[model samples]
Target: MKETKKKVVNIQEYKEKRKQKEVDRNELIALIKQIATLK
Candidate 1:
């Protein structure tokens, strides 16, 4: 039972990390677009 709970927690953490990474990637893309427009 304890192992199962740990697995669930790990999965949730992984999902959160993935989501944050996606957001960071999107923000980076937007910044690049702004820089391009300025040029």
Candidate 2:
């Protein structure tokens, strides 16, 4: 039971990290598009 709880916590953390990563990637993509338009 303790192991399962730990796994759940880990999964939640991984998901949060993935979410942040996607946000960062989207911001990067937007910046690139803006720069391209400026050129």
Candidate 3:
């Protein structure tokens, strides 16, 4: 039971990291678009 709980916690942390990376990618895309428009 304790091992399963640790696995669940690891999965949750991995999901959170993935979500943060996606957000960063979206922001980078937006910045690129803004710079393109400026040119």
Name the top TM-score candidate.
Answer: 1
For candidate 2, write residues 1-39 as lDDT tens digits: 999999999999999999999999999999999999999
Q: Where does model 2 exceed 4 Å of error? A: none
Candidate 2: how large is its RMSD?
A: 0.7
> lDDT tens digits, residues 1-39, model 1?
999999999999999999999999999999999999999
RMSD of 1: 0.3
lDDT of 3 by residue, 3-39 (tens): 9999999999999999999999999999999999999
- Give each prediction's root-mean-square deviation over alpha carbons: 0.3, 0.7, 0.6
lDDT (CA) for every model shown?
Answer: 1.00, 1.00, 1.00
Error of 2 at 10 (Å): 0.3
- Regarding TM-score, does 1 or 3 come out ahead? 1
Give candidate 3 regions above 4 Å deviation. Answer: none
Residue 27 of model 2, lDDT score: 100
The clash numbers for all candidates, in the given order, read 0, 0, 0
